[model samples]
Target: MFHRYLNKVAVVTGGSKGIGRGIVKVFVENGAKVVFCARGAAEGEALQAELNQSAAGSCSFLSCDVSQEEDIKRLIAHTVTLHGHIDCLVNNAGWHPPHKATDDTTADEFRDLLNLNLVSYFLASKYALPYLRQRHGNIINISSLVGTIGQKDAATYVATKGAILSMTKAMAVDESRYYVRVNSISPGNVMSPLWLDLAAQTGAAAEAIKAGESNQLMGRMGTEDECGLAALYLASEATFCTGVDLLLSGGAELNYGFKSQICS
Candidate 1:
């Protein structure tokens, strides 16, 4: 176990599974005390027990629905109470709904996505900034590659992610005075449970998976561990980085036209 984050405290949202879980594990393995939350108590508690037993750092879990403002507020308060200060706030909670065309999407659906994907980040940052400023800590927002590069029939999801990138830059500018850095990660296609579930929704999971793999220049999907390592870099090592959108696309956006069949 590394001691880079030996005495730090980090709070990760939606940390029971997928990318959030990966981030939590990375932080704990690096020796940072972590307070992670998820709506499912079973998974959250199980992860807490498993990590505390095997990881170099300690971890605790809480039941939280990031869609609600009260839950975010409570989460921040509880973390400060337990750890006295927050060294990092990782906003990793959010959903990517099934593809839907603009004509089929409704106002309520858009608002709901905004509340879950965008507003929650804002609320968490707002509540955690005071403690973060005190510790000169940073905020790592989990955005998506599709936010910059458009996706098919996923306007709402894309909108939220794009907004997150913009918001991260604005927050960085405003929070610079406090010495609190703010940055974001835009992952292209990571092989997580959430990604698989979305792929299955297409009715041809295997084909969708293949296409996803082909979309990246590496001819494969990224792993949760990769995302975790990127977050670790931003939080611990990239001292000069702020308002930067670190793209984890595996060269997916390099050359236009069509994916190189030769490489595949």
Candidate 2:
């Protein structure tokens, strides 16, 4: 127990599973009352129950479709109702669509994803800003390495993430006067359920994951647990940091040649 964020009021989006799940768990364990939302009521309720059972700081879950502005409004309202003030907001609800050639991707599909992956963050931020301003709290946006370096066939997703990083900086600057810090975390290959599912879709899940790990400088893909800690750091410890993207890539972006027996 790191009780760094004890008695804090935090909101997490898409917190039923994967990196969102990790963030919620870590925050609850560290004594932050968390109000998290997801689309899956079953998973959300189960997690709520689990967190309430043993957590030092309890959590509640709301069934929310974050892309909807009404849902985002209700979510922030519900959190304020429960906790009185907002101290942290983790924008973690975005999704990546399946790989498709840029030419094959329909404009409508791109717009739909853009709404989910980008506009939803905007709505959440807009709705939550007043409460956050009152508390001088912080926001952590979960972005990705693909947004910085680009990935194949994920133009729309990458674009959304890039926009998030840009928006984070803009918000940080705008909110500096109010002491509401904003930052982004760009994680590379955080192995979540979604990552495993994608791997399984490609071929043998275990082998696919291994192949992905080999590309990392550490020769292992990051875990959602690691991502959670980074979020916790931003939310709790990095008081001086704002308008920056913490690159959680396990050194994968280093300009070093790939490891090979001969090269080594």
Instruction: Pick the lDDT winner.
Output: 1
Model 1 residue runs over 4 Å out of place are 259-264
lDDT score, candidate 1, position 99: 95
Q: In candidate 2, what are the lDDT values of residues 92-134, reduced to their tens digit? A: 9988887788999999998999899889988899889999999
**Lowest lDDT 10-mer window, candidate 2?**
255-264
lDDT of 1: 0.93
Expressed as tens digits, the lDDT of each residue in 1-264 for candidate 1 is 456788799999999998899899888999999999999999999999999998889999999999989999999999999999999999999999999999999999999999999999999999999999999999999999999988888999999999999999999999999999999999999988899999999999999999999988899998888888899999999999999999999988888755344753
State every prediction's TM-score relative to the real structure. Answer: 0.96, 0.95
List of clashing residue pairs for candidate 1: none
Give lDDT for model 2: 0.91
| Model 1 poorest 10 in a row by lDDT | 255-264
